[model samples]
Target chain A: MSELFDPLLAPYDERRRAELVAAYMAVEHAAAPVPEVRFPALREPALRRTVAAMLALSGRTLVRGADRDWTSGYHDDVAAALAADPACVLPVEDRAVLTLVLVHSVAIPRATGTLGEDTWLSPYPAAADELRRRSQLPVGELEAALRRLRTAGLVTQVKAGGDEAGGYVPGPQFHRLTPGARRRLQEELILAAGPDSPLAAAIRARRRSNEEAS
Target chain B: MSDEWAPGILARARARVTGAVSVPAAEPVPPGLAAVPDGPRTWLLPSWPDGATPAVLEQYELAPMPLDRSGQARRVLAAALRCCWANLDDAPWPGVPAPVPAVLDVYAGMTRGDAALAGRWATGELRRLADTGWLVLDEARGVVRTGPRTALWPHEALGPLRDLLRRMPGPSREALGDE
Candidate 1:
């Protein structure tokens, strides 16, 4: 089939174009970051630029992995702007559930020094029973919300194992967030989970300074 | 950077995160969307590169979006296809709207005993399928139509689906009497 030449993709040959498209599709659609070793095309600087251009067309940004991987997700600024319009944001109940998960799975662990990384992925799964106790939502409503979150890749269920009753953790979709988005999420978690903490104060101070600088 | 294509690309990208965006009937369908045959609006189905799918995640032991009951969901989708898709030769988007009961009947037919129970299970599965865009459920109209995602099924795979659907029973004639 004769393909229309997209100026953005013209730098690459047909095979390269195919590789770029495949890599983009895999990144956007996959629940997790695609390992760079398997998709060598992502390693090429020119091809990576092409992918970024393609992503820009749609208001997305390329998520370069800290580990060897690649993915694409909403550009943080664009997403925040969109979220200002209520329709574009997650519903209030869903946000509540997500915040609970983040607090239990991420913030609490980090505060206790059990978790080392700033990434959303948490080894300390939030126990369902604990969530039930902490949540203001009714059990049925909370369960239903969790189910929706699970389906959307916002949270994943962990199976019970020796010495640990399985619960929930941040899902693969978290890996798709760009670095800016990840930092923003971390800051948001800190503010929500530890509003009075010295760390939250520091974050607020930094944000204020950055805003003044801008 | 081209001014003309920016809005279209933005619309397609937003639709990827959100659901299908509706285009005016008189307006051209955006670049990424494939127009639904004889349907009111176009639906965006991302064109995947050859031999790549969301399943690529499996190679790295990553699970795709969790489907609550995949087996039941697929069975419900097959039943929706059986009901809505009238022509074997054509692609299955914008297929004829089949009454909700009719699709449920076909689903119930797939299992032995307790048709009512099967129908209940099928109803739940139908909602889940509708939620994921595999089928469009029109509750007020009491009908179900094949959704845009069905268009993603590759042409080569349709032949096997055709054979399987052929052997699978259709909605009993008595059930269709009301429609």
Candidate 2:
């Protein structure tokens, strides 16, 4: 079974670094880091628009709701955003997984990463488990995915085995979608997503609704 | 006033605009693309190009307007603007704040301080001046220059700036800078 691991997601670590810098500035500006915030707490949870645009460049757009069914409008908007952007990296599926991981994290951002484990991680423990469960496929599909990411130079293996979150946390520098990285992702997103695909249609419909409401 | 105080004038204009527009603030802050900086202010900020409103403007400086017209004056200006803009055709709209006479063609919609713009330019009537092509908004230079058509020599062909609001859907960006 092909492995599902993605090494390319490591650049997200760089993003975390940049965000930390911004957060530190905001906290300093606010006179404090909102002491209530802790290593286990989410400092900033909203998917910033610019960051969202950046992630879109990675070939995946964050699904803005709790629903599981992906929409075409979402894909279209994500594609459009990426098309306009030159940043981001990772193939389509990897970007999708990365986006989903980040999106779901909004519900609980403190659980994984440099922030360390927190209550935020607990709520979505199921996600990691799902990855693990899927990891058992005979040919190591998950492993294969991770290999592809490594070959693309997006991920680096630090160690084997999954964490308590049941997800493999790659090295610290694999999560960001650098400018040129995104172009590669855009192509993958379109290829895996397919033109006229149901996912694309739904994304388009969602965008239409949003535009109409505005 | 010397254009050297253009810096001060820019600040004054900003304060007036901030007071005029309703900015939608949310968790993810909306993008403020134009980072026009305040003259003496430390922060390097940009004005919302063509998007300035009196409300946003109040943040910078509140210069008392030269006119004494009251609320009713707005209606007069609106009427005049409608007459002048009535004939303009729809064009590309960048969502930028173009002047009424230039592209927006609706003078009444563009307000300056408490008094309707009519008095600011010493134009006897807002509707009258705008319709005759007497208004020119120099947003970049931070000034509104009124021509002589309405006073020195009226343009007989120029009509009131009404019927032009219909063209607002897609106004050309040039109007904002087309002089």
* Candidate 2 error regions (>4 Å): A1-132, A135-138, A151-167, A170-214, B1-179
How far does residue A170 in candidate 2 sit from its true spot (Å)?
6.4
Per-model lDDT: 0.76, 0.33
TM-score of chain B of each: 0.79, 0.24
- Among these predictions, the greatest lDDT belongs to 1
**After best superposition, candidate 1 residue A137: deviation in angstroms?**
1.1
Q: Write the per-residue lDDT of candidate 1 for residues B1-179, one digit (tens) a residue.
A: 33343566556555666664445566676664555533565655544444356655665565466666777788889989999997878988778899888898888877788888888889978877787678888889889998877777768768988888888888887777653
Which candidate achieves the best DockQ against the true structure? 1
Q: Residue B100 in candidate 1 has what lDDT?
A: 88
User: Which RMSD values do the candidates have, in order?
Assistant: 3.4, 26.1
- Model 2 chain A: ten consecutive residues of lowest lDDT: A65-74
Q: Write the per-residue lDDT of candidate 2 for residues A1-214, one digit (tens) a residue.
A: 0011112223345555344323222221121112313211122454233333332222333222122211101233333443443333345556444433333432234423533321112223225445445435434555556545433333333333455334333321222233233343443343344557776566567657988998
Off by over 4 Å in 1: A1-5, B1-6, B37-40, B44-63, B111-118, B152-154
